[model samples]
Target: MGTKIKISMTAISIIIGFMLAIQFQTVKKPKLRDTRDIWQLREDLLKEQDLQSKLIEEIRSNEDRFDKYETKMKDSKEQALKDTLKELKKDAGQTKVTGSGIVLKIAPFEEAVLLNKRVPEVSPILLNRLVNELNMYGAKQIAIDGERIINTTVIRDINGETKINGRSINSYPFEIKVIAENIKAANKLYNRIQVSPVIDELFVDNLKAIISKPKESIEIPAYDSSIIIQYMEPVK
Candidate 1:
């Protein structure tokens, strides 16, 4: 029993010594602390804050750029739509046109007037033939006696009088305005009309067709009547 008691006391002493050594080591090595001065610490904090501010500014700048880009895209789309509408209106002959073109003056032939014979009225067939020939020669637009000629124009004989677009051709020496694509086209049209057999055909009917030289600018009136649409519906 005495020997067992002595062995238990020795074990307790060894455990106590191990705990004291661990405590002594902990005391000898103090915890590390920041040793930078207050000014240095403040400068570091300011640097971090400046960096954060720059990042925020960059984000804001990017957002602004994106907004501008979106606005530009929207504006471009609207402009394209406007341009398309304008072109459609022009093509439909709803707008007045000005371009390089020529003028044709129609009057009674000199020979017919001197022969003491009443000048014959202009024939619808002859006029229609003339219009078709002009179109074949690249006439973009045409107007006769202050009336715009569109795709729907009708020239016919109504009660012994030649009528165009339902309006009577009341007198002689009327003007027919013809517009071409450009100055070069206008010149080509002039050259072709000068030698066209249509001129001789007009002379056969006791009428003279005097074609003017190509002009740099000619104005054609727009179609004034309301257009009647057929077999067409708006896209949903």
Candidate 2:
């Protein structure tokens, strides 16, 4: 009976030893694999952080370059616009200009008016004809009675008196200033106007048209009237 009891105790001890070995192996394998996994995860995390830092620096650099480029473009555009405005002002007669040209004087013949018993006021038709001839002869800028003639200028007979831009002009004698493109053009304009039929027509009306020879320099004042556009649009 004692031998049987001893054999049973040995069997129990062997079974307990086997079970402890299996549990220990299972826990140790998992711990080793977890250590490797943790190290790999840390390496990956560090690499990702480095990439993120590089991307941030690149973004900052791009923003700085963009700011500089934008400023340069803005400055360039502003300068271009300023130049265009200056040219436009000159062409629109918003500024004074000087060039070689001729001056024309119109006056009523005092003796003829008394003899013919007719008023010697210059007619709008006669004035318009003279202006058109001057333009044809290369007259660049023209002014009558200190009023600048622009594209928007209007001349009409308002209430028995010849008016320009809604203002009455002098009756007997008035001056017309003209600016030509060049000295040659001014001479041609003067010669052509001196012998034009317009002068003959004026003479028939008991008025005298006298033109001066080409001057070295003539100054034309800027247009003083407002330029208002009522109904005009540009096509695309």
Candidate 3:
């Protein structure tokens, strides 16, 4: 009776161990890793790879866009050159000059003109006439007391003070540089002028009228002030 009871107990212990081992291997092992957790790991890996590819493609596209922008910028700069030239032409206007040259220097008016006595000061009409006659004789650039004339301008003696191109004139010896067709003709042409006795008598430091062909460059600075050509505007 004692041996039978001992054998039954041993059989029950072995069966219990076998059943627990089978549960760990077949049911508990698969249930421990949930379906949601496995699916999340797969999605994370795919997202990481796709993000890397998108970053690389974005870098390449930005480089191409930058190159195209640089080319457009270059073309814009070249196109701006034409506008610059047109501006230069309008500012300087046009000059008609031929062959060689002559230079006339004007000294200060006599004390009567400067003192504002009963005598009239130098007027705009006289200066304009002189300029017109010089242009007719083919002067290139006309300068009054070192100020260059671009647009049609006036020089006037205001009371005792003098002004040229709407600004005050400072120093003495007004000058005119002519591009002469006939060098000898300048001497003959100037003699014909019916000028004031006081004007004809006035003398510059370098008094003689000079007619010489310019071999070197003659520099005349453009007018410092801007001129609006109201006559040349388009109708509104």
Candidate 4:
């Protein structure tokens, strides 16, 4: 009986030891692994955030440089063209006149939905094309909601939304102000606004077109040097 008791005690000790080892591995090992994995994840997230911040900064700097460069380039090109025009006017015995003109305020209607979308819609391209026509008609200065139209300025859609000059502009009531030397000529030239079917249809509602003759002195800045001249020594 004593030997049998000793054997039972030894078996119980072995079972307890085996259970303790399993408990340690099941509970402690996973907790250690989880801690390691969480630390790695946090580090990775921080790295991503840092990269994003750097990229944003770089983009902003590049944009600033590009803006200056584009403005300068546009000025140079416009100046060269103006000089050529002046020479032509001299030959033709015509003088370029500067006079008070009209300011046209144009904006898209605020209404986004219709009874049904079965009909077509007005797009930004239509507005852009109209602006191009105005420039072609010799508009002295033109601005859309305070964003100046320059040679390098491009009207683009950003992120499936309306935007101009890198800023998000709503499609509601766009204000286009132009200062020209001749209002009659400008109006007569732009009478074909109906050519842009989208603009004519969409802006037909709540779209107020006003031509104001503001005699404000508009000083059109001169253009910069757009071309470079190179001189070579004669048979050096």
What lDDT does the true structure give each of the candidates? 0.85, 0.81, 0.55, 0.55
- Candidate 2, residues 49-80, lDDT tens digits: the string is 75676568659966875675567567797765
lDDT of 4 by residue, 107-226 (tens): 433352443323222246755876765654445556666565555455777776555556565654456666554656555435533343434544554454544545444332222213
Candidate with more favorable, higher TM-score: 2 or 3: 2
TM-score of each: 0.65, 0.63, 0.41, 0.38
Q: How close is candidate 3 to the true structure, as a TM-score?
A: 0.41
Model with the higher TM-score, candidate 3 or 4: 3
Measured on C-alpha atoms, candidate 4 has an lDDT of 0.55
Worst 10 residues of 4 by lDDT: 220-229
Candidate 1 vs candidate 3, lDDT winner: 1
lDDT of 3 at 113: 51
Q: Each model's number of backbone clashes?
A: 0, 0, 0, 4
Sliding window of 10 residues with minimal summed lDDT for model 1: 46-55
Cα displacement (angstroms), candidate 1, residue 90, comes to 0.8
Return the top candidate by lDDT. Answer: 1
Name the Cα RMSD for model 4. 20.1
